[model samples]
Target: MYPILFSFGSIHFYSYGLMIAIGILVAYYLAEKKIKANGIDPKRLEWLVFSILAGGFAGSKILYWITRIPDIGTDPTIFTNLGDGWVVYGGIIGGLVAGWFYCQNHGMNFWKTFDMVIPEVALAQGFGRIGCFLAGCCYGVETHAWYAVVFPEESLAPAGISLFPSQLVMSAYDFGLYFFLEWFSKKKKFNGEVGAAYLIAYSFGRFVIEFFRGDMIRGVVNGLSTSQYIAIATFIAGIAIIVIGRKRFSQSNK
Candidate 1:
């Protein structure tokens, strides 16, 4: 795992930034390859990537700031710690909302675009999770398991004890999801089937992983992890999309 790729005197090349850049590039690469197959111009993939970048980053950072409101009153230093606020779920929400607006404004079919890009989203997550592993963030609670890692240099280590590799867990889940959804990509009945499935699968995985996350996190609702709550909502949304899409398919067929 590479937390800092290199250093030029006081400046550091961060693993998180590198991984995120590479992941987005790969996601865009795959999206460009598949765009034409979805009956759209491949060039528009550029726009979609922008939408994702704008949405994802804005969403994650904004959500992080909002969630830190309580901490602002108690911990004056919270404002100085920009790195501590980001949440993956927030990024997803932002990216989705932004991308949806971009598509609508550009007169592109939102559902079809989502169908074409969902697999790539999961693929990106796999790469991003590996970044988290290198940065030693998003890790698990303390444990003595054989796979436990003691990250002394990582800022997010759990109380100076070895903990579960929650980042690796997420990486594994993302990889599994990539292959599974790719296999079923052709079986989807409508434009957004893969998107719906991805939301459901990712939400379920995130929900389970949140249970093992040992890092300090804030509660946004009813003392539950903010991510867990978002996962539940996304999970239900995925189910609803599948149900509604299938119903539409049935009616169209009849």
Candidate 2:
């Protein structure tokens, strides 16, 4: 794995940060195209995307800290060490919440906006996982499989051990999900259906992938990782959104 892509005389360019920036730009391009097609004011896209990113970052960091409460109690400096640790679920939730508020404030249709944005979120996540793989974070358990990867000494993962490539798997899944959701959005019966589908699909996929994860910073409870528990709740919420949305749509038509 290559954490530092390159170093200029006194400055180092990090692969993780680079990939994240790439993801954001790509996602924004796609989202802007979609919003313009859907009759949304393209001018609003910047502030909307900014709000979601800001909220997602805050939420991810806050959840990471929450999971490390015991460690934080032992050493409070962890709170100020902002460069490491993030939770994807927290980012998803926070981004959605922030997007909802933005939509409401701007008199935009929240569900329609959510449907348009979620696919790009998946696309961004796919790229982010690539960053995780390059940085050797969110690595998988040791394995002797043909596809196993070994990080370099400088990477975050343990060096000299062949481990399952969970990050790549997750990245592939996210990319696939992005394609599927993009297609599904066209055929969705209700405004929130696409977003709900994203929630359901991503939660199930994440829950399964968590078993392959080797990192312990994410926390474990009752034989399952914290993410798995959140996945269950997110799955349920997705189902509820679909059911309620359909019901409301039917009632309005009636």
Candidate 3:
């Protein structure tokens, strides 16, 4: 994998960073279209994006630190490597909390805005996984499958070893999820229904994907990865939100 896409003089262009930037821009473009369609001001969506970036970055870093506590105990300098080690689940949680607060402050319908925003989030995540693949991070376990990939020297995964293309797999899944959410949103009857569906679908998908992950950077506790636990909680929360929303809507129609 080409981590350093190119370098001009002292400036280095990283494939991972580039892909993430492109993803954010594309997601913002799509979100702006949805915002205008929903009769909401684009300025508010901009503010929400700001909140997501700030909070998501912090949350992802914190979770990463937590996962590396074991290593940090041995090498205190591990804490200083702030350029890497982020957990996507943490970012999602942080972004959700921050977005909810932004909506409350601006008098926007949290669930409605969330429903519109999540599809874009999934789309962006799909692109981000492409970055992961390019950087050779978030790799999959070794396998003899015909579809397995082999990383070159200087790559993140074990060099010269055949491994599952887990990053690409997740990226494809995220893209499919974005389309599904976008289509499902039109048929949703409640404000939170679309967002809830995203939670359930994504959490379940991640839970399954974790089984193929080769990296141990994502901490494990009690025989399950930290993400697995988070996924279970979020999945249940999603189901609860859907059930409550449906019941509330039903009651309102009576």
Candidate 4:
């Protein structure tokens, strides 16, 4: 894994950080295209991206700090150490909350914007998983599968051994989701369908992927990871959205 990108005399870029920036940029580009197609103001999309970054970063750090306490201080000399802070689920929650608020204030169609963003989220997740692959974190159990990836000696792990490359697995699933959402959006009979499908697809993906994660994360009360809980909740929310949207459509047709 190429965890360390490169170093100047005193500066270095990590693969994880660089990949996340790229993902955000890609999301912005998609948003621009979507805004023009949907007849929304593209400027509002820029504000949405800004809010996503600010809130996602803050929430990711907060969850990471809470979990890494005692070993890593709230204030540390080196922030975002390779194994230190970052929880992907936290970033999702934060991004959703912040994006909703931004859309509301700007008088954008919140559900419609979410529909616009479903494909972008999949694309971002696809690339972000690549970052995890390069960073050697969020890896999985050892495997002899043809797809297995072994890290270099300097890498750290819960067991400090070469293991399954879960990050790549997730990236593959996300890319598939990107295609699915994109195609489904084109065929959607009404608004909110794309966004609903995203919640359903991503939730199912996370539910299965958690099994391969070698590391133990903060689980909800019943020993399910935070992501599993979120997945279940998101799935329910997706169902609710579909039901409500369909009901409204039927009523309007009356």
Candidate 5:
């Protein structure tokens, strides 16, 4: 793993940040094309994307801090370590809230916009997980299985430990989800169906991936990680949304 892609004397180029930037760029390109094709206003989409990024970053950092609160109580200085650690669930929640508010204020269709955007989010996340792999964060538990990866001294994961390639697995899953959602979009019966499916798909994948994750930075509850609980809730919510959307669609037609 290579955290610092390169250093120019006093300056350092981090792999994590670089990959995240790349991901965003790629995702934006895809979204922009989609917006134009769908006849959506580009300016409003740009503003909505900005809101999502800002809110997501804040929420991710806040959740990371929340997870570390117990440890912070024992050693408050632990809070100083802020170069890494983010929760995707929190970011999703925050982005949704921010985007929803923006849509409401702008008189935009929230569900329609959400459906268009969520696939791009998944695409970006796939690249972001590659960043995680390169940075050695969100590593997997020790395993004698054939697909184990060994982190070097420079990596964030414990050096030389043979571990599962959880990051790559999650990355693959994200990409797969992106493609599946893209295809499913065309056949979806309701406006929010694609967005709801995204939640269900991502949450289920994440819940399973948590079992392979080695890092304990993400908090756990009753043997399940915080993400697993969120996954369960979101999965249920996804089903409910689909059902309600169908019901409403039928009522309107009737």
Candidate 6:
């Protein structure tokens, strides 16, 4: 489905890569605006973003490799083939860890920064899902629904079969979540509320979406996809954060 966006004299630009780049830029611009409005040091934005991105990339790749461990015995290229395979959950965790460390090192308030940035992360994910759709990755199960899509021969999805279009669905969910997070942030009683809400909402959404997913490359454990397990844990973690954060806020106020 038009994976190659354009070609320039023997060089081709892929739709997936292009869309991700656009997503990063858009997210970064929005984050800058948010940081400035919140009185954060605008200069710290560059390094903070860089650290999160680097950590996210590494985490995604590492998780992908872990899932492919079974394939490694059959295909030695599984570890070296860095062109594809990444776990979104891994990226989320990794980015947060990196951001936390960066904030600690730079004397920034981690929860405050995360609350401001998490909505942008969802926005970026919305664009990234568009990339996944264009590349025909993260495809949905075959369906006879009227809204099903059919990928061409060049696409990664099974060619010419009507499918559920899960990528677009996820994209829409991400976009909607971004707006909801933004609204929640405004009404939040504590610094970590928005970020915690994000984890809960996104994890639950992902857990449900996994049922629609056709690709099983991400591994399954005990009748559930790898992400489903992670989603459960993430959801619990989110709840824990909210409880702890609210308690801390209450204590501080008293």
lDDT of each: 0.83, 0.93, 0.91, 0.79, 0.91, 0.93
Q: Comparing 4 and 5 by lDDT, which wins?
A: 5
Clashes, model 3: 0
Worst 10 residues of 1 by lDDT: 152-161
**Cα lDDT for residue 8, candidate 3:** 98
- Candidate 5 whole-model C-alpha lDDT, 0 to 1: 0.91
TM per prediction? 0.93, 0.97, 0.97, 0.88, 0.96, 0.97
Compared with the true structure, what per-residue lDDT tens digits does model 6 show for residues 139-243? Answer: 999999999999998888999999999999999999999999999999998988999999999999999999999999888888799999999999999999999
- RMSD vs true structure, all candidates: 1.8, 1.1, 1.1, 2.8, 1.2, 1.1
Candidate 6 stretches with Cα past 4 Å from truth are: none
Instruction: Give the Cα error of residue 19 in candidate 5, in Å.
Output: 1.1
**Model 5, range 40-83, lDDT digits (tens) per residue?**
88998899999999999878878888888888888776567667
Model 2: per-residue Cα lDDT over 1-254, one tens digit each: 99999999979888999889999999999999998998888889999999999989988988888888989878898788866688999899888889899999999999989999899999999999999999999999999999999999999999999999999999999999999999999899899999999999999999999999999777899889989999999999999999999999899999
Report the lDDT of model 6 for residue 90.
Answer: 88
Q: Is candidate 3 or candidate 4 better by lDDT?
A: 3
Winner on TM-score between 1 and 4 is: 1
Q: What does the lDDT come to for candidate 4?
A: 0.79
Residue-by-residue lDDT tens digits, candidate 1, 89-181: 889999999889989988998988888788888989899988888887888888898998788654555546788999988998998998888
lDDT by residue for model 4 (55-85), tens: 8777776776665555555457435564445
Off by over 4 Å in 5: 77-80
